[model samples]
Target: MLSSVAAPSALLPGASPVPVHEASAERDRQWWRSSVIYQIYPRSFRDLHGDGIGDLPGITAEIPALAELDIDAIWLSPFYKSPQKDAGYDVADYCSVDPIFGTLEDFDALVATAKKHGIRVIVDLVPNHCSDQHALFQAALAAPENSPARDMFIFRDGTGENGENPPNNWQSHFGGPAWTRITNPDGTPGQWYLHLFDSTQPDFNWDNPAVHQEFERILRFWLDRGVGGFRVDVAHALIKKSGLPDWGGRADGASIEGFPGHEAPMFGQAGIHDIYRSWRKILEDYDGDRVLCAEATIDPLDRLTDWVRSDEMHQAFNFAYLHHPWDAGDLRSTIEASLKAFDKVGAPTTWVLSNHDVVRHVSRFGLTGGHARSGDGLGPEDNQPDHVLGQARARAASLLMLGLPGGVYLYQGEELGLPDHTALDHGHRQDPTFHRTNGERLGRDGCRVPLPWTADAPSFGFSSTGKAWLPQPEEWRGLARNLQALEPASTLSLYRTALRLRRELSLGHGSLAWWPEYDAEGVVAFLNNGVLVVMNMGTSSVELPAGELLVSSAPEAGRDGFLAPDTAVWLRLA
Candidate 1:
């Protein structure tokens, strides 16, 4: 439960409050710098039409709920017209809405509704690839070899006996070979095309001027429709080395453990920055503080900062922070390094715990070991997580993340303490990764299950037809939002209180300073906006600093002036 404490005095002895700079019109326009953005997996957020799939109308209906959480924006995963080959990431038409989600009018309505609630919309933009069914790709298939149409994508002749093998040793991110052989319009085996992900999603030839012009037009179309910004998908892989060079890595395309730079021929090419510079010009030409957030997965986080340069991207997702273990020292080092790196480029660091491509943080923290690798879904065949321990740690982590001095991204249903459906039936899995790997890896279906809204309602009130695109676990009934809303100590309630106080105190815009006096093994303490935020990751309780208790992740956080293990508390020192 939220602790009841005395109001903070205007001033206190030996306390230095983090200064909140005066907000000018320019500062107000740059809201993304210190904003909290909510990511909505459109396929699972809500099924308003009872088709067992979430849609634009469902998101519009939930604007009030998002407003209550005090988030600044909503980042919708791909809803573009597609064949659903890659679950909407393989966009067929960048400007049209998919029938499975809704029509263009429905999307317009969502934008209008979000604007009315003072929330901006950020759409997912997949520029690296497109669905094979796209008109240009179809034209490329029908055109003769060496035709201008074929030049829009990477199509090269194979180099082997009878030209039967892949052009190079490059591998797909999903699984299997990256190149797929295609049949010529005549009855003969022809050149192969490159696809970094699934075969249905073919990579575009960024070297072509037409490809650049097409993406610019797509960007303006969405910006004209009043979107606040775009979350660039696979931002680092847009360009490849001039020669399709062979790689000496695993067939699965996993990065090496300690590689210092972009050794892979397919990713982090210097030419990618030129594309973004051109895009930045287009965004600056717009009216609002339109942003561009990169989803680049480059390693050695210092290299990742390149995407967030002032003239490139507004923010880049800090994967190092997301994948860090639950140890106090590890988290502290990651936070400090991320702050320092992004500070050099004058861009706010973006923090995230869970997303559509990874296991939920609650389940990840519940494991006995350190952080779980992305796409390593938990299941009945594997060791199960301790629900009680996972929930406690997740709550504590939330407080720590919220108190940091940068932007934050909240995955949908995380506020309700939802854990991944780890025990989902294998037969029901739909992720391409699972099929491509032949069930060797569990993929991300566990974290993409439909959210539970009502405890007893059919399909947890997600769909009127009592069906969901992905099945929800029966255990989720206990974590339903409707039931948790009435409980003061619930995770949902904790998030509400934390976000409210964060905005009231302008905590997001404030600075962070490590409080070294309370820093010990398995303990992390920091000061922000006159609040001493402390987390005890150790087994024993620690003495709390003298201050009024503002809020806590656990009910017994400040009991007897001691902060309990696995608990986080925010104390107002002034």
Candidate 2:
């Protein structure tokens, strides 16, 4: 599906579309209300210790670079102690930093340094489950059946003549059965425990009071360390339906809406809201408008809003907008629905284009031009990505995302316009997803490859000892941060400029109104804080709205009146 773009076919511009509204005064609220938070996948960011892995200290060393980008906060992926199973998603300890990542002292220093630079830190919280090596889980494993330690997790009796089968038909998010049979101390077949993800990560029984109390203590422990908020991992999967029902053989375990089993008993249960409500209270007790942002994939955009209610989470990642195809109509519909839904609960909408889990949008937008479908970890056997085309579209997509009202998150390497390492070798793969699916689904390691800092430096300067946990491709040398910083037109420069203007124009904290001037099949135009944003997603160049050009994602600003296809521009209206 990675093909060349079609020739442009110009179409006559029609009358005004939706009317623009005046800018609102909401920009003066808390920093989070309109903040732009950059997500840092700790493992792939940088490695200062030269141990071939990124650490908290390495991230602290990069704070000045992040500050220069004008971001208000940083959402760090899990850095807690873990067994490295599921790439740190399987946490062994919530209160301490992993030895590989750093110690608690290193974490304290990082937070202190980040605070000095006026950047807030939002930590990733894995409340749904913990690694089997965790103290609580270990105690549960050794304790007798029905002990309080075991009660904290979802351990249940198995079915079948010899009790060899799992408790239910639920599937793991990584692929395969969700339940793993455990053995008793007597060396006999025993009960099974649920793990929505990898087998090493056991799902906590949220129904248990001890589980709730433990999480509350975990929240306070981090809050005491000065974290501004949390990015809740698998926020929807924490609370499952009371009955562990059959999944009906559907494979899309992450999604709760589609497939034959629409109401999957594993995730997006109604009780999840109560958990957020309690966490929200903990955040309020601390200073600063500490927030909770959910990584929820609940469908029907409106229901997704429930996670961001007044008493629940402050923001929920808008995956609907992130997953929308590059078609203008689809994007416009998602934007409209997101605004309307979030507005109902007085919560700011959070927009994100890429994260550690999904295929990078740069490569994603390349295949099929606009309606592409590329899975993560695509190797040599898969269709190659059009990096040039992908980079161009990715730049435009950034401007469009930043210009909208509310918060936005920029993934680690997106500023460098890094496309997924589509040809990663199978032996280097680490995501449990790849193993669980037996290489049938290549996991998310391609996007998680370590960042490139210096073009010619060993390991792209990601590690001083000349090795990276994941190999960096030679093609990435040209896209390194140092090289991009010198090029004014580079994707990094575009993001720096866009983020600066997003604040100067008060776009993030303002209201959005559909531009009434132009409405074409594959074009979307919106006005926020007197700035008119126009994007041409169609095969043809569209007329740019009249205004002084502030910034254009295209190499050159539209001459005469037309914007090139796949380009986006911000116009400062008179």
Candidate 3:
């Protein structure tokens, strides 16, 4: 059961119940529409085996702590059997747990423990590709051209003299040609295979019925294990345009982002919807409000909304909103656009600030220039972030995001006010992007550093042996969970208070209305179920609305009936 926390009524002495609808059976079935799901990168979450690598048992042990946050669900990143080529994103076995993470029994314990605390488990499902070490991929390598095994993946004969060049111009996302030539039984260059990511992760030929059947079986296997749903990885890239067309005569190894349209040959294909519609049926068969959340990065809010249509996925990450600069106008416009777009498909918009694959929001907001792009790495050689300013903005952003009327996805360490290990040494990096780019791109290893639990313990209490896969920064000592647990003004305390009030007010399911009367030049003011939520982004303080102060991102900044810049507040209208 979730740990007891002070109720909003207790926090605000004269506050009345917010006029939001109560949860019922029907609402329960549609719980995901307004759910707060936390993404846990398993390898960095906790290490119970003293091996420096976190596992399932480590997560199970922290169930009580998670339950206290009042999150509706926990989304576990890929823990499937893999070669660790892409930090478990490259899966060799979807149905079993990786030996490093623990056994199947450990996973079962995690599911049961999470369920007992009213938290649902959402597994990461990688369907666009599989690890080269997968049984089917190995068989495909040995099988003759046009053989059934080879047909399971995209394979084609090279085009140039002596078949030395790749069949297409697609480039690997990690920084190289997307195709890798395979050797036949006689040691001849048999054919080339496609890998949108690392060469070790070969793209699956979704055109094959066998591929569809295999994933469907994999889905059922986990659904039977009591998982609430799956977070579909690269949800939009599963189906590529037929004929393997060239990307508009671009350079052979050019970046995919340089391509022209959202309907590029490699992504946002219409056929991908058909695939989700089938998975939706599988989820519908289950008793609970099972869901499919998409990790699609398609451009234009409308195109991304297509993944979350009523008959398809339940939610899709709003990447456009995530990448937007921290300006009131930009944020407001994005929020309005996202709400309108997802509303058209009868699906809820999902908001996110930081995730395992991107630079943490704290550092991004603190950058001297514009926000950092996805897959960007920060280090000692780069301009350092303003730690104090970054944390304040991050806290304000969280309050603003939680006040919106939709589902929210919180990254693992955001609540603890964690920042990326921007000064990590190059030699200590492990992301494939770092190696593939030949040290050009620093990659996402900085944000994936192990969590800090104890301020004084070695490895910050992440592992008993004091060993961590990715080194934790020394500055994290003050931000450790133990020290923050004792500080009432800490980010963790604010998160707990906000989460409790959000639940009490039913804010996630509430309606949103722009309170333009209170909006200033750089301030965003809105009313969520009669609660006035105000965020000041300008350089000076703004007069607060007539309301009883309930919670503020920077409480000290709310003095004199004025909200300071880089601060946010939730209030009950007087």
Candidate 4:
């Protein structure tokens, strides 16, 4: 049984109201296809160490809280040994843990404890590239230009008369030339290597047999250590088009992400599918239901489905849906397109609204209050967000996303309704994109700020030492987890109830049938099994179809069956 829709309750003076949730009924083995996975950007989650940076131990300590959320799995961002150049995306060693994050023992304990709590763990795998300081990259620098170690990366001789120019006119996703010239061992000018992102993070030559073999070993090493799956970072980017041709003005004016630039030679090349097919075999060889989820930014819904066919990866992030504006028509089209495309190959569509790289959806939805951006992301320099309106929309969006028939991903602080720290100072910014663009563009640091856990604790209970790598805004105190947990009308409570009801109703694993007869112009109403999910995206209140009201995103009595604007409700169909 699930909790019923009730009026919003006043917050208790010093108590946190944790909801009681029923366990979901057991289902098929391919649970990854429809499970709700929570993503933890480890650095911003919690810091067990006084050093002010989050660690694996901090994540381990929070497993109980995570288990309370009733999420089926947890996807931890990169915690591998790194130079912090790209904030852990730049992997120095895939098999080892960064000292800052803690020892390998801590990660093992996290996996063990999470399993004990009936939660699966998915680790981030960065096989597309490695930190320039990686052992292989160092060996490449020491070996000769045409040596086998140099072949491990995308190294090529310059093309100009004096070999002074780069191999091509390729530009880095971060900014500047994608190719970086290196000095030879003899201190003479040397060949250049390619890096789609920052120069410190060199790209691997997927064409190289050694690169393929190394990633296979890396995957097996983690799987053997009890990780249930791997979330392949930049999954669509490993295999670039042959000959590295120019983008031909396809670059979207320095934007790092968007559909317009996905067609360029740098992303979604055909060969990437073959790699996933091979990886699928590795996942199958394991005893348990190990899975692979791609962080693919591929476009064309049909092409995106290719990565999730029966023999390829189990799931890929539905980025197109995430980038859709907060309009009913666009949202409906995106949802329909995603479900149709994935259904073609019998793959589950993975719905995600926010992640580590993009602007938080709460802020994105509030863009109309003068925070609009023509691109995928909005920065601190953008107009101020209407927090009240953003929170309303975010709450409604959660119900709509969770009611869909597939897997969903929840970024750490989204359940708290944390908007982007849009007032972050430029000098405190750390994302490589921000520095690479000379601060003209504020990168993703605003969304990556550490979360506030307690309203009165030091560093908002994120760390005991009251230190944080990125500062938390003063406003976060009111939105802290401890405070929200005590408020029945809080966003955190709404998420708790929604996730619990999502499982209790078996809403995650089903087919969606839209009821246009019950839907208004700006409304979306769908039926799944005996449940009807109605969302009012329009300005005015709309009449809901006759059914027993189970829950809603807003706190209001059923007034003549009217659903409030920006509200979503689940009704028990007769």
Candidate 5:
């Protein structure tokens, strides 16, 4: 039932993450694997208290609209109690609300609300570390010699070898050393611990038994609270090279960032799998599939399969599509490769066109005109899709991703065809990393902007207060929710139609039949069941055999609905 093809865009001669989707699992497994997932970055979603920051309450309010989109689940970014460092990725407490997001009662209500609407809630679990200000870490550091808490974290003595010799050359993902030199108010000799990301966040020593118990409790805490699953943050980094030695500085001008000046090679270390095995056992205790999607993309195709093998994770993301260049050859080969790999591993795949981590697809591909910020190498003309000739070709990408053999991940606002706004002054930017780097990193704060739900309403009805968190979608009020929803030809209307078709027909879980030449430079074709799906990438009309048209990204018949440029059409082949 699924289309299988060779791997796409290989750099190394060897194949990666072979596809291993099990044919015997319920179609729903693959459905979710292929289901459409909508990601919600809470801090920028909505403000229930008008506090200039988004909250769970705001996301709660928007659930109805998402449900209408027929989305399978909402991948909510961390809403757990945190100091807000790295925007909720740093947990201060595993079981409580951060007060700013509201109380435990509120989260419970949100979980209840989502389930009542048949929606699943997936929270961000940053088990790789905890906030330095966390009570346990404080207690451990306060009474290391005598505190049982001391064993909870990774603490050690160094030979006072001066700053030149670090315990290891571990680099922080944000900018420096994975370890920090900290002395109590007493100015004691410093101890070392791993922190793969920001210094404020420290990596948990998963090799320790205490680390296992704490994480298990954290996992069960959310599951007991009605949360369906978690998206493991840097999940692959949990294990290290073990009893590590110094990697020395690269000396090539690339000192590990954020960290003092080194790189952490703990990634994909052998010990990590044991940690995953332990975590998997804990997850299995839950009543249902407790999704454990990893933030792994180093070797996506191979990594995906490794993480989601029968004994590992239930699903992994398909970032290849996101990273691939937008052309027929790449798209065709990638999809075919993905299908083949899934088949090999008996695992499922999820397609995320956009998320809070990277540039928006529309922006990345320069699919939307009037915005030249994305680095897709397009001229001013390329941004502007030729309306009559390019609409179908453009819409084809969505159809292909949604109709593929696995899950689909959709970002909020994409349902409304919102375009990126490159209107930020240095002073207006809020991303800590972007601000720290002076614009070198895109920091994902732009796509994290506020969503435009109701046009005629105040602040697009996303918040009831003044100066909402993150900027509101500029000029969206005119093409606002109510207005676009009222007009059938509007982009919102198209989204509605597409979602409805997807949900009503159980589109995502089905097998994909990508055209034999999925890599065709001008068109991306596939057979979904009995229907033929075509997306024309060229500037001229492309013809399909005479058949009944199911849906068209553009209006009018293409000779027989010849299809327009940058648009798509689906038909039932005679």
Candidate 6:
């Protein structure tokens, strides 16, 4: 429709120049193989221009911080154009940066700056759905009958007398029906489209080859813009049931807390494999070992292994261990399952005990004495411990994550000894999960609030603007990064030392075997290479049948492999 108009310079109208150097073949070759990715929720990071929201420049300015963390890369959450209905996950445009975050130029500068720091940028790609307001969706909505664009969405006919029944009884993850009826200009009604999430976010029909082409074009668009890789979101839900059957209504009569929402029979459909294969092709060409990490679920751990079969994804997160009890038997089976899954895919494994979504491990398992605290009915003993259990659980989880065969992914505050607690009043909750009005609860939000860089600064240096997007947890003050950096026995110090050791041994190079838990009550014990890993689930100290302590979650390390209350021990085997 228009001719190419050239700008005076490649730079934007007004911007400072950042050095750009093409990454060497070697640098990109094994880029994601052993890298540790730090996820950045743009809304919770620094607000550069003080618009009360974090932007590209703010992240660009913090590249030095990431470089110093001894991490593999930075995985940024959605920054694409969107209406912010479901945050940026409901992408409006794959190629453009949301104006709220910054301009296209800012994104380019951020990418260049990151590459210069020996870090690759892995973006959160949300292609399964798009904002209802997106241009493509709008075009499809306004199309003449039987148009190609119309096929992009799941359109259904109107029901007379009765209000239009949704294509099925499938529920949206955020709340109601997976389908929404559209009204025509005249008082008449038009067809409906399927949305797996918030209604404003409509699910794309993977059956449409055009949809595949559209996403492929989007992939190249960002790769050309210099993004190193992608962390595919809701990846397994790309395809849906053609029959569109009714969901056996909610169990508790609540839409959100029930299974019918996230794991609709439509999820992980067989047809979605072609979608991944096509994406893999574009990724192979542009990425020098660039990876596709599917946020595969932990509950039904086996469902997405096909995606990680090298043909689909480089790795998928095993969410099983993150929710495990501190028992030896549970840990053994969890590790066994992962070991088997890893061997099956012929791809490496990734481990973590905490992330933005789950309750922090130290607070949940280690501190609650193995039970996550009940948030609703609490009038009893506060029996809180004197010292933070996070210190011990942090070390324990780290020993498990880092000592595993694959790469270790530690969330931001985990290394800082941050404690987890639900300090939010009922009205202040912002998590997207909708729960049953009864005893049920939605996902945790306070765990992912913000990272504090300094102790003396206000809001722990998280902001200079209005209140933070999520309330900073009570554990924020003393655990600031700048403070812990100086303490020898601090969590930050331990993390740095462990990471250096991991890099030295090429921890990424070896495979792992989980030894039996060495206790009467199934306490987890694993043999990492030759090191003995024993975690004590009991309140008393447990002895280790091994060498000197390389690291101990408990203060009292005994020759008998004695671990303190809710603690873990790592020792070299003779």
How do the predictions measure up, each by TM-score? 0.95, 0.94, 0.94, 0.93, 0.85, 0.85
Query: How would the candidate models be sorted by TM-score, starting from the highest?
Result: 1, 2, 3, 4, 5, 6
Stretches off by above 4 angstroms in model 5 are 1-31, 145-151, 155-160, 163-165, 245-264, 367-394, 517-521, 556-560
Local error of candidate 2 at 118, Å? 1.0
Q: Clashing residue pairs in candidate 6, if any?
A: 328-522, 542-561, 542-562, 542-563, 543-560, 543-561, 543-562, 544-560, 544-561, 544-562
Q: What residue runs in model 2 are displaced by over 4 Å at the alpha carbon?
A: 1-27, 249-262, 369-375
CA RMSD, predictions in order: 3.0, 4.2, 4.7, 6.5, 6.9, 12.8
Task: Assess each prediction's global lDDT (C-alpha) against the native.
Answer: 0.86, 0.84, 0.85, 0.83, 0.66, 0.67
lDDT of 4: 0.83
Q: Where's the lowest-lDDT run of ten residues in candidate 3?
A: 1-10
For all candidates, the clash counts are 0, 2, 0, 0, 54, 10
Candidate 3 root-mean-square deviation in Å? 4.7
Q: Tell me the lDDT of model 2 at 387.
A: 79
Number of clashing pairs, model 1?
A: 0
Query: Which candidate leads in lDDT?
Result: 1
Which pairs clash inside model 1? none
lDDT string, candidate 2, 128-215, tens digits: 9999999999899888889898898999888888878898888887889889988888999778999988999999999898899999
lDDT of 6 by residue, 1-574 (tens): 1112121122124432221111123422364555678778887677667655778888898889777667887888898998886668888888888998999999889989998998888899987889998988898888854688888888776445555676567676555566888876575677888887778888787788888888888888888888778888877777876776666745212224555334456666677777888788888897456778887552445554777777888878777766677666777777767767666666666777777766666566534542334442111133333236655766666755665556566776787776554455545455455332222344455565677877777667776664466667556788888888888767777677666656665555454544433435546666654555566666665554536566654345433445555666556654
Model 6 stretches astray by more than 4 angstroms: 1-33, 158-160, 249-264, 298-300, 366-387, 434-444, 516-521, 554-561
Put down candidate 1 lDDT per residue, 168-225, tens digits, no spaces: 9887877788999998767799999999999999999999999999999999999999
How far does residue 300 in candidate 2 sit from its true spot (Å)? 1.1
Estimate the TM-score for candidate 1. 0.95
